[model samples]
Target chain A: MRNQNTNILKATIKDIIVAFICIAIIFFTIYIVWGSEISLAISLVNKISIDTSKKVLEEVKLNSVTNKLESYPEYGTKYGTIKIDAINADLPLYYGDTLAILRNGVGQFSGGYFPGEGGTVVCMAHNSTKYLRELAKVTPGNKIIITTNYGEFTYEVFDTTIVPQTEMEALKIQNEEEMLVLYTCYPFNSIGHTTSRYITYSKLVDSKYF
Target chain B: MVKNIVSYIITMFLILFIIMIIVLNVFSNTILKKEYTIANLKTGNYYERINQNIVDGFKDYTVQSGLSDEVLEKIYSQDKLEQDINSMIESLYTGSKINIDTESIKENLLNNIEIELEKENKEIAQSEEEALTNYMEAIVEVYKNNVLYSEKVVEEIGTVLNKANNIINKAQIVIYLIPLVLVIILIVINHKQLKFLQYIGIGLLATGLFSITPKIISELKMDINNIMAINQATSNLIQTIAQDILNRFTVIGIIMIVIGIILIIIHNVKACRILEETKRSRH
Candidate 1:
């Protein structure tokens, strides 16, 4: 009877062990599968956010031109016509920059402007099929003639400065005579947003072209 | 002596099994749940911080453009929108408490922008062309900066959320597997407990079935609204699922105890029958 009871007890223990093994296998398999699903869900959420942001940006761009057209008349007189020979050229002009119309239809102006007031008018045109690259070769004393419908404005570059991006306040509008500042990203052929803006300050030498 | 030894071993096995169950349940329900919840809460807090950063950054941008209450309100609204998204995501991951749609938020934000732009455009049209152009330029500046800031915040939130999910998954696997392995060892050491084996199997099956039942029901009842209401609702659903799993374990525990009692009764009856047969043979 003692031996029989021992045998029964041992058998029961084995049965419990086997049951645990089965449970373990099932539980682990479920856990891994569920865990993977959760990970996939997270990835999905990220993708959705990125995709939505892109869509919104695209929509904003599409509406910008129309919005600008509706509000164009109040800002300034049609002082002069600015032209860029490059196809699909979209040149945005901030008021405080200068426009320099060069020979051969090439133009370069001060790229940086003051935030609030009209200080310098930077005008840019295509050089080698790019908007700002050709200005890289421009040196001091280069003549930038601006022919406004009212009058012709000519400026000669008197100073040049290589400034960091953060010193953008240096490009602020000055209170004295209208100063023309021309700039572009330095070291032509470099990729990415221009690290440094090449600045040239010029004064109105002549308004004969107008 | 042999009978005493066997009885001791059997008692030890039973005690171990009970202990293992208790440990697993406690870890799963309290420790693991708390870890995941804390992780989720931290993620939400980080999201809020990032949103605040974006708002602060935008306020600076607006200050540069010329400060306006309208711009401040717009920033506030955008911040609120971020909060809404964070809350929704939290709900989806942690519990089924609230439902919110990402699409609706997107639509609302877009409509708000459109309305503001239209109103500004109309005003500019009525005014001088120069003023309108200047106003448009300012709007363009604000919109561009806002978009850039929003994108960064979204990306950061995604990164944090991914980390949290990974942590939760790993915890689930580890916690669930440990008790299961322990139970297997218990069974292997007590080979005479065949009835216990059957009981444990039934217990696990019942637990799994109950745990997953609500999820299955939810899936069956899923609607388009759930997809759109993906943020807070998703977190809430996950929390609800966790609770369901905890409840299932409780049920499993009770069932195992009852089965153990029945097994003990059966074992006693079998012993009595064997003794009677022996007595008759001796006579």
Candidate 2:
């Protein structure tokens, strides 16, 4: 009886091994024949599968020595606030200058620099009563303060201009000096869209790092 | 012994063939079939959820335009959204040009904008007419894009799907024919000893395990439920489809494994009984 049981057990083990060998052969043959195609298919699927596990926002830090930021805020997310005492306007500031962002508060042009980066920082907001409608009242010498998670900086308005919306030169990004360019749709009270931008240029006057 | 080895080899080939059939059929039945996917979308409430997404998306634009949400009201009916989405999916499956009519949306928006302007006692100046046209066009564009996801992407997928269907149709003949030939050969070789059942059982067992392996690995490696799409509604639909596929694969695998195990057990019992009888006769 014991011998019979051992024989049966051995036979079953052999059957299992054979099954595994069959699987191995199938995989090996596929690898030999269609390996590249399979790999390409996998890579394509991976490309479209968005991995939302990655952080949507990261901690932003200003590098004082490099005159740059260690990390930047995610676009479309509010990272700071812009305040102009002259207009009594205090609004959230996002990194990307999209109309969607402007709907809520102010949006910084992603191409520009962060405060304390010693470069141009451009921001825009909708010309609504709640947003930058009072922006026209702001003149040169008025103060605009930007408060971020890392630091605080004050900018003194040096000039204001109305330029055609097509004039990209008015919002030029540079690194020579820390400047702030704030803009809104011109003719703030217009019922619909306007063709020009009201630009307020300011120079950095004070800074406080946290 | 040599004959036995050849039978096992044929059986291995048979198992590999069945696995291919399972994979191909799974794809053909679910993702490849336009009706199947459309059914999934309907059961998943994709239309209503996507409608809400479009509405929410428009809120941001309306706020920037200084228009009240009233302008968006009744601009896009749920029926219109459903019709457009279904048309887009049909185009994807049929490899056809997708043309979503934004005319209705554009007209509705213009009328609403005019109503809002009337309320404020303002007229669109001749100079501002271009801006108004652009604004209306932009809103219509947003509506179309939100409904279709991305036109270029959908068109490319439609093209690829057409090519794949052509290839699959041609391959189906060979995919089915070779397996039948292998099974016939296996039976002819093992018929005298009645050993064909054992080989077939072993083939099935291997195929079942092979089918289940990918599902197990995917579940361990990634969280399929949290798979993101362009928006929450689309994301939910994608997750549902993925889960359905995984569940189907698992069920098919289990069924194969169960049947395979039963056949193998029956063969083993018969072999054991024959051996015992032969021993008694020798004694």
Candidate 3:
């Protein structure tokens, strides 16, 4: 009876091992063949990537890139310096004229023609007493010199006039000759919005291209 | 009698648990063991994700800068933008990131400006070009690392993923085989009641179907509005993936069904043979 029990026990253990092996082989084959696909499926179900509706990402800190500008100035960027001897005005000149740009310093209107283009070069600034306020007191032949990356151009104040704010035609580019226009708000020291513009027109008397 | 009853209950629980382990192994094999991550990124959808990220970044920039939408769009066409980013990603893999010199991507993007400008017929002068280039460079700087996973993430993902796979595989194998071995020992101890193994067969069938419970629950509770709100391609891909998961479960379930039926047949045959022997001996 003892021998018979031992034999039955041994057979049972063999069968159990065989069953476990069979189960393992079946599952192993599946993992070997289809593991990645199933995992991807699970992941896809869990992921949140994109949708039709718009939602912004979390605010990330942006490290400002140190801009390495070429030697030549670009439009809307500060590229030169200006000096008005009569007003003692020395200011950094930017190419594009916008409200924000003017707040910083004098800015040239980009829509108008460029220097050496034989057209009107319009430059404007805020009417601060220190900057362009003294333009009103300037007489003809006052030296207005612009130093740029490209070259330096000196202009002589030949004329000055107050034009209406709506008179954009007064600042129109003339194709016949190169002229520089410096203008600011009227009253020389206005606190609020103004309709009249203080204009100082000058002819380009001398130019030196670097 | 009570001991026998307790033994049978334990045996049934053990069988159900083992069956569930088998189903989970299939899951572990796919999601954990396979390198589905890099492959999915390599798919066309990776580009789509990138395009979306770029659009998002630009949208954020415009909101902050007060730049006109028209001007920003005119600066760089979306297609060219995505292509440029794709090129950057491609470069990072100079056949393994061993020589992943990311500094070159900045130069590469700057160098390829001629083709982009030409495509749009934008006649920007030298000054304008300089300004635009600076703007583009600034944009690239701010978003280059933000738009995707970081360098550390990229470098370590392969090893980290495989390590997880190994651990889960070992755990699953342990859970699966331990109960199976116990049930085998129980069958030997309760030889007279081996016919009760039919209960285990039934449990296996039930567990097989239970494997797809996540899919069923998700579908039942799925909001139609949410689906409509998602992009069509993404939504479609999601459905495809869900279906694929369901199909895998169904395959395992069907296999269990076969195994369950076989177990039931074997138990019935053994019970009938014992019944015949008892009747003949009494006669």
Candidate 4:
């Protein structure tokens, strides 16, 4: 004889279909309300907060007086903008000299002094026309301007030297001058690689001295 | 009814996304893991690639390996020494098997010195062989100490790779099958109207193709040298391994897409038979 109670899974196909549709509706509602929408809302909130914090930091930089900036800037981090009116060369300056860093803008050597520190400040950039290609023509008595969050400094080129890259002694400070020594690979417009460096030596002309 | 339709469409999209996520998770856990990478290095053609890299960078290797300039002077010219090393490494693999042939290195060194001596048209001093032997011994000793000192590392990698490979192979089944079972359950629950199966089948097919995205992206040319800024040999090894992993993923994606299409066809044919049976019963 048949059992008095029916098995739970025993149902008409129609009944099961209705249950399936109901489950789908529940799942859809749950995801739309709590899953994707919630994540989107959270990301939007984070974006706004991050933007405001960045702006405040930028303001702090603009108003910084003769205080010292970080002695070491992290790699690929944009700390200042550099412009040389002589070559009309304008670009962002990063602290590290990885090939990638040089591609986007000038790369400052971490071992040197900042703009107003009164020691030799050394920097480098790619030898491309877009970068320091005009560096080939930067003669003595031309101006190189550096603008950072703290202050601005201008360097008037006094000497140009083409030396073997191994001879970086020219970059060293010989006296108490806030010097800006910038260099790039020599034969700046060469088809292939060159083993020399074209260097520009300039003493700090003026600054909101730090 | 419209709400139901909206619910149905949203659920379909959710199911599609879930399937994609689960498959990608499986890939991340298995293929992209360090264990898998280490295993791939050990078990694949990476060793040969490494050998080629070593040859291409022989001078740098000599300096980095701390071989003194005096010792380098004794070993013929730099280019000649480089050739000898390249030849030794070129004979490293026999078909698919790798025998580093490190044992034959001393013999190879003697042969090279003889070739170099002949090139200079030099008369052999009876003491020349002994002097050459001394230099050979120094070079071989340094090579073994510096380069082949990673036996412990290799052993550890072998153990880990074997364990991970086994787990990944088994988990591969679970990756696709769990989603398949979920789809089947839903299909059976809504058996009266199997139209949703058509959409789910297509979703599975799309998810399968998505599984091979790493391979697809790698084929695109982009200058990303800085992010991978490292020694050339190491970077080359990473690029090769990434390519290998993506190729494996492409095959997996193709397999999943085939299974999906088959499932959809079977469901549609079954639905047709059911519809015909209902009509027959009504008559």
Best by TM-score: 2
Ranking, lDDT, top scorer first? 2, 3, 4, 1
**Share of the reference A-B contacts seen in candidate 4:** 0.00
lDDT for each residue of candidate 4 in B1-283, tens digit (9 for 90 to 100): 6634653554455455554455455556554465555555555544454454433333322221212222233333334433443333322211122234444665654565456456656555553445344445555555443333344544454465556556656766665666566666556655565655554555555555555554554445322222241334445445555555566677777776677566556555656566667778999
Worst lDDT 10-window in candidate 4 chain B:
B89-98
**Which of the predicted structures, 3 or 4, would earn the higher DockQ when compared with the native?**
4
Task: Supply the TM-score for candidate 1.
Answer: 0.28
lDDT winner, 1 or 4? 4
Colliding residue pairs in candidate 3: A35-B29, A35-B30, A39-B30, A39-B31
Best by DockQ: 2
* Candidate 3 residue-wise lDDT, A141-210, digit = tens: 8988988765688989988889987899878677678789889876553322345788988898987765
How high a TM-score does candidate 4 get? 0.37
Q: Alpha-carbon error at B277 in model 3, in Å?
A: 5.4
lDDT (Cα, tens digit) per residue for candidate 3, span B142-186: 445433346565446545555655666667767777777767766
Q: What C-alpha lDDT do the candidate models reach, one value each?
A: 0.45, 0.82, 0.58, 0.57
All candidates: DockQ: 0.02, 0.38, 0.02, 0.03
Looking at candidate 4 chain A, the ten consecutive residues that score lowest on lDDT are A1-10
Model 3 error, position A29 (Å)? 31
lDDT of 1 by residue, A1-210 (tens): 676666556645654554455455545765687968755664554444322223321111112222111121112122243322322333433222212123123233234322111246554332223355556445667665544333445667778777875776656556455567665544343311234566766766654421
